[model samples]
Target: MKKLESLPVEELLDQLEVLVDQRDDGKDFLLHSIISIETALLRVIKSDPESDYALSIVKIESDLKEHLVKYGTYLKTEYRKDEISAKSTLKQALRYDQTIPLAHYRLGFIAYKQQAYKSALFHFQHAVEYQRLKPQHKMSLSNQQSYHALLYLSNSALYLAAEAQQQSQKISIHNDVEQTKIDQLTLSPLYKLIDANSSYLAQHAFQITDSEGQRGASWEEYEELIDDATKDALILDMTGREIWVRYGGSAVKLTILNAELLRKLMLNSSETVPLAKTDLSDLFSVQSGDIKIERYVKSISRLREKLRNLKLPLDVIGMVAKPLNGQDTSYYYRSTEILFMLIEYAEGGQ
Candidate 1:
């Protein structure tokens, strides 16, 4: 096949039309090919936003979205029979449009079924967030999806907290450390989860029920149960490579090195001490030298930029300057009282 970028606009439109016809006729068509064509057309529009083809491409994209959603819903209903295909189809639907709550809910359900709680939590959170933004009249099935997503979000958090507690207990036993301290660290994730759940409950009146047809606790009652556990802090799951912000439960994606640096900063933040640039360089195994300090400072700068781009508070990572032996200035990094938790999964959990 010719490269998508090399194809003329007319050829791209022709291919899209053919794929739409095949999809509508119940004939086989590669979803990837359709996606490629759409991406190419989008790139063209991005380069020339005022082009006449933009309107046509927009209409074609609408048709593509409709078809993808219908096909994805069909596959989701059969997910129990062929999970791989269902997941791929739903994921492709998301690739085309990430705002689809139904697709996110289905993916979250699949992750929950496979006991991948972290993954489930991520998708369920998105499902709930997007579903709330959808119009009331358009939410025939999505309202139910939002409800189930909230339930599963809490369930996923519970499972993850239990797992973290187990891991902490094992570590305490092996290392003969203080159980209270370990428990405090391990249970911090629960605090974030509870805060998120409580915030949602406070905003939306969801009539959650038990599997046995029993009425579940109201938001007020649920708040009482977790009153002692609620705290305002970021939750960083190092093993899961995910970070949950306070209140909104938005997940922040960080690069691996940045995440490790954040973990180190959070660990030291308990003592309210700033980590010097030299210490950060040592943590990353950078050689002790002027160049090492420069590289580490740049890394910190990049991390702050990432946080800013994600609309997080820059004070999450604070920078301090001090005199080096009253001659030159040195920089140090400190984090707010953010909580870091490790989430270990079995191989191939996803």
Candidate 2:
């Protein structure tokens, strides 16, 4: 992936031109090519910081701060918040520099705070898009913000399911070679987030009407859509030495400890199981202490990084922190909405 960003300037531009030309060719091809072009462009800009393209990106970033200040002023000055002006300024920032991920995220947050879920979803999606296309070698402020964008994007989708008007503009995630690529490249991560968050939403009182006009309580409609999008499942093999996550035509392997954590949650599938530091210490045979907790957390983080590299969902190991008595805290691993299977059982049943 890093190499993709390191191509020569002429080559990167040629590739980008080809991709831009195919922008309207089809969504699948467009997304695939766009990602490639973004990777190249990010590399090109890094290699030549003084380039016109790089300066344009920087200028857009500077303008984004100006717009944000204006947005803040609008919130403070108007008795009734001038959301329209704030949004207009942000959109204008995009017109000058569409690659500005921060602008998109700020716009998304504004819409989200205002309870405009559909608008929030659109901006967050673009934030995700820009973040995904950026070079991943180094961490930028925008990169850190993308994590929050993912969270907001998923929540926005859930809320949008409740909007009657949103039903009319259903996400066109149908089947075909191109559509499949589009779904894989663009929609899979969103579905993963929704799947991870579903259990949390399930605990609350809510109802959603899907694009199909089918109504269900507590994110059922969104969950069903996520299920449909997920054609594969994470499965435990008979040997118990590894975990296998299937996605489209590929699979990712996991370490035994990681596999067990997923298996424990998947078997329960609905409960948020408490996992104390002591529990982790016992499970991994590590000495109980802050060190053990740190190691545990690092392991989980690495697992997420691996899944992300595989283009699989980060929901593979979903856990939320809950404070225990005193200063101690326990992590609760939730089964949430992930679909899982035992490879041995699947084989035996077949």
Candidate 3:
């Protein structure tokens, strides 16, 4: 097999013509030859040649995209080079043709890995929007890939909203204008659109909201990452912004605050140990006697109902009781049937 570049441009073209002739007869051979021709053309273009020698720039750009995306995906899967090669090739593809949706998607995926959610959002939006505008014949992004892009877009917006909510909480801004901005940040229309596509994402969108009254679930059906054993045992995984609970052979993802409340109960699951309403109020950042404790109490009651419905041993989580002296009540969980684990991120890292 002669090196593709060793052949002259005319010779490569002649070979490509022969490959086209054999396309139906020798499909494998034709495919191999097409790849060879594409590689040779890329080499020629990279050589800074005087002319493309009758090669159409549009065709070359289109072919390069397929090659780059395939090779880039391979490199990404291999994980040996850490995606640097794939990223560089995709960047080259973008330089060759700015309108290539795959190139933009690859770049956006890289940004997502780097946790540059804002940049990822921008690139993914462009890739999806531009690809949508192009004719069907020119479409390079598959339906599944487009769906994934939409998911990533929604997740990015959710992350941004979560971050903004966290910031607003830190400052405790009371002004109506600042409050409105915080509300907008927490309730993004983009997330609602994404959530509407699936019930799982809709629950996710609910968790990410700043709504204090949102009902937290132990786990959502979409969270397949948590194993069956965990679900059967009614275990709770607190990682990321959501708390995943497993109960009644069903799983639900709960909000961070709700998970925190459960975590507190789990830590003090011994009968000798109990969490006072005042302590719970402090954990929730509310005054000791504030009416907000009622909400926290309601959340605990919901959690208990979920656990009881699942028939999990609730001995660990005793109950909420009123003190005989008319003082504020305390909650306790003493059963060992339920287990809790703290996860730092989606990968289950510390």
* Candidate achieving the largest TM-score: 1
By TM-score, highest first, what's the ranking?
1, 3, 2
**lDDT string, candidate 3, 1-350, tens digits:** 77888777668767765664454222322443565576686676557657655345445556546555544433333223435756776776666667777677767868877889998898789889877877363435755457667877777777777676777766765654345554545445645654564454334421211112222222453355355554434456554323466654666655434555676676554545566665565333111223355665676766665555455655446654665545465776554545443332221111
Residue 3 of model 3 has an lDDT of 85
Global fold similarity of model 2 (TM-score): 0.28
Clashing pairs in 2: none
- Please give the CA lDDT of all the candidate structures: 0.54, 0.48, 0.55
Q: What range of 10 consecutive residues in model 2 has the weakest lDDT sum?
A: 341-350
Judge candidate 3 at residue 306 and give its lDDT: 51
Best by lDDT: 3
TM-score of each: 0.44, 0.28, 0.40
lDDT of 1 at 42: 69
**Stretch of 10 with least lDDT, candidate 3:** 205-214
lDDT tens per residue, model 1, 1-350: 66887777778778876764454232323444665677677677667767767666555555445435433323322123346765776676677678877667777877987999999999888878887776442222334445657777897888787787878777877566766855666566676776676565444332322212222334455344324244344544332323222222445556445655665665554323566665554333211122355556766776676656544443567655554443222333333333333221111111
Clashes of each: 0, 0, 12
Tens digit per residue, CA lDDT, model 2, 78-120: 1344556556656765665676566677678778778888899
The TM-score between candidate 1 and the true structure equals: 0.44
